[model samples]
Target chain A: MSATTAVPTTAGRRPMRGLGALTASEARLFLRDVGSVVFAVLFPALLVVGVGYALPGMRDPIEGMGAPWDGHLAIQLYIPIALSLAVATVALSTLPTQIVTARELGVLRRISTTPMRPQGVLIAQVVVNLGVLVLASLLALVAAALAFGLPAPQSPAVAALAFLVGAAATAGVGLLIAALVRKASAAGGIGMMVYFPMLFFAGMWTPGPLMPDTVAAIAQFTPLGALSQALTAAWFTGEFPALQLVVMVAYIVVLYPLAAKLFRWQ
Target chain B: MTTVVQVENLRKSYGAKVAVADVSFAVERGEIFGILGRNGAGKTTSVETLAGLRRADGGSVRVLGVDPRKDPQAIRTVVGVQLQEARLPARITVIEALHLFASFYPDPADPEELLGMLGLTEHRGKQFAKLSGGLKQRLSIALALVGNPQVAILDELTTGLDPQARREVWDLVERVRDSGVTIILVTHFMDEAERLCDRLVVIDEGRVVAAGSPAELIRGGNDERTFRMRLPDGAADQFDLIGSLADVHTVIAVEDEVEVTGSTHVLPAVILALAESGIVPDEIRTMTRTLEDVFVDVTGHAPEEELAA
Candidate 1:
């Protein structure tokens, strides 16, 4: 038969099967993408281990939270730190770069012509990123538990909630940045610029509350700082930090719509 | 028949440069419609708008009878695309790329079968970054086709390939067209367009200056024959005598060279006249008009100058 004839390749399939297919495809691609895999898993895990190992008596501080906590109490603090970096990498660097290259390669344009939704594209990205972070976070937790005696999470539900919230906030911001950047090359630069500052001010390096008065106060208002505070509070105290939660949620609320408006699928 | 793609007065600008302006076209179902233009002729911008990748600064577009901008989700499920200049991750094998893209569509082609058809079966395990340029381009096409799209948009279809590889790509494109899918081929190559397209539109300065079948265009471009003749010493005066014959419209001479512009059918008579004059030119050549020539004539500049225009 001639090539033009609609072969039975994908015919007879049920409609609306694209989303499932898209999700699977996106997940697999994310898994194989070395940069993302490294960013989501190894990078965060290394940072957690490196930072945890560097600070003596760090585990004492967490177990001192009045309860026995878990094995390596200090590792609990590092859990949120590792998770935050994973979220930022997936949302900011990995996701944005994917879209930018997709645009450059005409993948976005091709998707645009398909029955696929731009929102679906974004959904796939978030799903892949979130899934990767969850997997990596789990591994990091296990590794930390084994090596440094890191505390097992007290509240798994709260950790999950914090992860979702943190991921949502970062993914939204990353999508906005991706939409705004002109080309693929700019994605890395923009991600680094946004990432380091966010990591520093968000208390991943030092608690915003502990910084000198002016810096701490300003850091509190930054999205990362708010998100990190909220994530830490959720994982550690089991009490949601309302203000920080509001700021994190507010980042998504503003950025998601703006990103949708600015996103170029072609 | 319903229109599969429609574009109206589409406009797009980046900074001060207008990428596409007042561009419009429509593709009926199951035709290999070509968009021919020089580089930077707004072909990519126009296609991007229709593909729903870039929002138009103005005008409207409908692919598969839906507004791409308003209902991008609805559009994505039905359309299949392979973007220009896209590269898959280096670590992802060919099989991996196919599986990933196939997951995006509800019904996707079998990855193994796709690899086999695209001559990539042996390289399925190879990373995308490790493939040759031609192989990468083939992989790109395979990725586009895996979703089993109704309409396929290919930009620079045979670019960056050796002549043999280009011909192979042409065969593949023909096969795609034979499958009864409408194609919007964006290319700067005249020979490619002439060989593959049923009908085409030409863009100059962000607007379509010509549109028709390649044959119709070649025929319509002012019927005139150009002959180049190189002669020995005393052939000029004899060539002038031949030029005075009927249907010998215009003849110019620069030294021993003779250029004849007239009916191609009358060339033999001119040659016979020359024979009678005992004037035998050493070399004789005829100019057969082509799309390339028409492009030059219409734009009043060589096609090369407009490569990035």
Candidate 2:
């Protein structure tokens, strides 16, 4: 029953002040959230390193061409693939889990109450995930180039385009998963179940084209199949598929907005 | 004063289950209006609609004169919300959480001032998971107020606080109200509602069963008032001496436990007589009817009555 403090009059201002502020705040939160940071950057880099080390001693299906499997070319080939996996893991696992956890924790629920747009929230996730994916991909590439004598890419533009396409496609798929699953535990499982299979099928371990006819046909149609094809063609053969790029772009255009629409803040 | 929040026949249902049915209430500028109900009584659902979290199947809601469904984003900037069920990332530190939430607002309260006000200045650097429940709750409160909002929505404001912590929260809430920020309090604790809210709405089974000031509702129930006395040890016979005094209607005693039922006019006289007799009870308190009693009368249970039953 003590005297109340002075009332401030600040509500006369406009809503949706500026995305820059929100984006900065979200970025800070993402960095402050140590688990998300590791998941986005450190974990993916570790995975790429593990895959690179594990691959050098194994049989290379396309090694007959003397393409130098452990050199920069092979490792550069992994730049896009590693980035793709990183993107998928980030959008699928990190975004969905955060959304679900936000809902459970009432963060989303509270956010829903404010003038903050659901779109802002989605944009924040994409921004954070994109940062993670880019940083992780860079770290992995630098490590591979320095430590294992991984090959540098023949075409930087092709490699960059391929990485962007792969990241967008992965983000779309991740959004779809987040929209469909509202609970953190369920979303985590779905994200892993859906993305890990894509990794194995996308030539992360076994080349997709060398697989049995049935396996190759099925893999070709999956989203990951297109990504693997795009990256493999760009890095290994110096050949980029315009059609595959178009298809990847199409996947992004369709899934990104769809996820945004269905994404619940609460 | 103009109403800061208005709801008309707000309805929300999930599949076949109606979570909130025709719940409507208004909160004036700068008043703490509590929504009192047990769990599953549609308190959360009702607040969600007002906050634009859940789409109401029927009716409409307006906060700061904006339709939440049509302009959820616009509404969010003007109102701060502290949901009962959620938490920030476990790794997030207290000051970090404050800064993060404050970033959403064009003009936000100072994070340092917010921490100081909430008594979280000491734990500003602690990670969210490491904080105690009361500390977490306080952080959430700080987050909700960071936007420098004209209105604040809080669910289960003091559900898990120890007495001292609860008092601290109550003080903070009072401070928020003083800031001219309209508040919507969703809780089942009648005492909390009585102590915090200027007016309240009670819900049961997704329907609003009562709405009024706490005093009016308590008076409307017309419940019998009781005088309770805890006498000193070996003072069992003191009840007999007090029970026979003038205006004392019914004196019931079992061992040292004593309860006197009478009109408000007579209870004080009896207590005064007891004090005059040189046999003062260890603890003497008048039992007035509360919102809890009214809930039981109207909804057939006490505040925590549902869970207890």
Candidate 3:
């Protein structure tokens, strides 16, 4: 038997010291997963480049659009849509699956035994996924700007804020999925069910002013729809999408607390 | 022998189904205490309360001088838990897990030393999903000890291991106890509790039915002794005579042999009675009741003894 080490007194112990290490380890694991990385980080960039180059007539000027919408290439509408696709893939699919799997495998229950609070574990998860979302969105933005001649964000600060609120709303939906589902496999299926619909409302099928008025009214309330609207307006028209930002913020306010209350660690 | 953990009449229920009715136990410092029981026998519930993972409906639980429910933060810092079936992410390497868990504590044990202690040094770079069952269990124990906890609760640590692997884990647990951290081993294996625990409480059907050292529980306060003996060729006439003896309780002919159950002196008395009939039984095997027998006697269920070597 080896000699026992000295026992440190419990005075002034920091339980949350592991938060940084926990987040770092989670981030490393997330990167190691090639599938999650490709879908969450690199896929958006691929979408931008693929649609801009392979699809015919993407860079051609529009004919019927007037004033602010006049002379815009067809590919200009895709930048925000691609960004929405990235958020949907990560927040709806990858994030929820990881959380539910960890829960089912007792990872969260194991953390409960440590000095760190269980809430720290959830926070670490959200932070890692959020970091990945930001990277993916930026990669897509750069890809569109360089490849498709997409204009830079006219109101850069507002666009950045809009992107954040939209990401939070999407993450909120993922958190709710994680809270309701008990199985990891089921989480993926359920995420996909929500993913396709959200992408539709984000204007993946119909870009900008081409969408019907009734659909636009309904889509503005959806997280991805609001994000696409905000990103497109701020990028092209240089106008703050105040309604879209408020809608996304409302989704976050409702979804985040609801998910937290329903979240099951074990 | 200071008591580091004390539970008094702990009671808990999930909705209408009661998980723990009444349970109490005190764990002394530096001892490998056991909460032995069958599955769904309130063992997990009791320990979960001590770890502050579950709250008891009624009863007091004090871990290291702090109530687990009232001062959950204090309990978490001092006590560590390796939950049953709890696993790490499939892609996380062994070393990364140790370092991550170590950071959860104020003063943690060296991760390198823990790897060596748990015999996982060579497999440090292996992902969690690639490790064998025994290796996964060893890593779980290593993580439990990495925080330098004052007390560690290991729930069903070796439930899914081969005999050799189980023994290896048993040795590791003893080594952990030798390092001066008190262990509360919750298990369903009779031999595991018998071999590892200094003192154990046997729980059955959500209640503690027996509690003591293995030897004491086996002894069972003047328990009956049983022995089986083969009668000499065609000498069946002496079986009833043995049962009729003063000290003997019941004698039944089982197949070719006569099984006798009686007082502590039954074995010698039966032999004497057989000798009086001028029949010397060729084989007489005296049965010493084990914890298995005691468990059956108390819980009224067949003991779930391991058939491993």
Candidate 4:
């Protein structure tokens, strides 16, 4: 028998050399999933067109607001709501379910036995899900703007910041859910359980201004609610919503590390 | 021979159940070593610990001379593992899975060559969920060898395969070993171990009951052979004479046949004694103990019995 005399030397590649390949493969699998595509990519845009443009008088200016705010259409507020829904669909439903399923299938365990760390797969999932969420959000925005003549974000920079922070906070919560649930089906059930309530607070069922005073006050503290408010403020008023940004930042601070600590490779 | 894997006094427990207790074995470089046991006999757990998938409760494990616990990633790079129940994504095609796993290593085997070697070229585009059980097993084996690893740990490699497919997989294993990859095969199939393993350790109830080469273990047990032959209808009186022979250990008459069991010399002596008595045996058969018998003898129970228990 021939014995190996020396260990093979690794070519000085970056530690994360495989991340792009991992993410690309995960992206391919993610696109093939019809349920995930329908909910995360198509559903949000459909909601915007069906709810935003189909409703009469939604395109007209809102009453009782002064100056530039007074003439903005109520349908415009739904754009941010649509974007938040995109984030929620991927982060709450798709991301956690995929992670938990991978764990259950021993996909992560198989990857752990390779030269690459199994965490690389998790990171790849995050990157792919986030990319899908962004693309879905962009599609929603474009579809809404073309169908309903929705205006562009007044503060593009602040809107970008809001989207980044919201995506981080939402995906962090998804990772936490993946960490807590041992079964893939349980992750899906728990994810949808968290999803509907967050969507309700983000004004999916009723516009924020039309909700009762108490409900509106409570909605501002929710992660999706804060994200919706920040995005709306950036899109219409050309200003950053400090309080909403802080709430999202706080969610990231608490959820990210907790998920990391509790995560199980097996 | 250089030791590729050394596991000493390995112990593991899940809650109150001791899955593996006091297991020890050493695998030499370029040899196909085996851990043989029935289901739930801790063979999988022992190999998982060697692959660095599970932390040992009490033991020292060195794979290619590196402590797995201290450097799991380093061990992972050199030791490929085909876990008993692991799988790829349901929608991933066979070629996709191969390419993806290939990217995980710095020096991976050519995916096309690997696919050809495992006879998976035709199924390259088939989704994982659509493959048959035997095909899936072959794919799993191919994935384990894609990294050109120094050591490969395969757990229950042919559990669900039919006889023909099982033989095919065994041939593939032999080819892999011929290429100089040290293999630690975990199996319960006696024939598989007997045919392939250079050395093996038989585990029972979370302990190593016997360890040696198949030939050595079989020889270590009773070397006596049993012989049975048909005598004339009136030869029953000769049973006592055969029993009284110097080399024969025991002699008994069943119906019209006489059964004699003793050392190697007993067979010839019994034949000569029967001839001297004017008895010509029409039928004679000899039974020799195999490794399976040795396993039963040493473990105090058959593998099936241990499994049922």
Question: Model 3, chain A: how large is the TM-score?
Answer: 0.92
Report the poorest 10 consecutive residues by lDDT, candidate 2 chain B: B300-309
Which lDDT tens digits does candidate 2 get at residues B62-157?
777777788665666677889886777677789977776776677789999999988999999998889987888899888889988878889997
Q: For model 3 chain B, where is the 10-residue window of minimal lDDT? A: B300-309
Restricted to chain B, the TM-score per model reads: 0.87, 0.82, 0.91, 0.92
Off by over 4 Å in 2: A1-18, A25-80, A147-158, A207-217, A240-243, A246-250, A253-262, B1-3, B6-12, B22-26, B55-74, B206-208, B221-287, B305-309
Segments in model 3 whose C-alpha atoms lie over 4 Å from true places: A1-11, B231-237, B240-245, B269-281, B304-309
Model 3: lDDT of residue B91: 97
Per-model TM-score (chain A alone)? 0.80, 0.79, 0.92, 0.92
Best by DockQ: 4
Query: Pairing residues by index, what is the TM-score of model 1?
Result: 0.77
TM-score of 2: 0.79
Point out the worst 10-residue segment of candidate 3 chain A by lDDT: A1-10
Task: Give each model's clash number.
Answer: 35, 13, 0, 0
Give all candidates' CA lDDT scores: 0.74, 0.74, 0.87, 0.86
Report, to 2 decimal places, the DockQ of model 4.
0.48
Candidates sorted by DockQ, best first: 4, 3, 2, 1
Better of 1 and 2 by DockQ: 2
Error of 1 at A258 (Å): 4.4
Predictions' DockQ, in order: 0.28, 0.31, 0.47, 0.48
Which residue pairs in model 4 clash with each other?
none
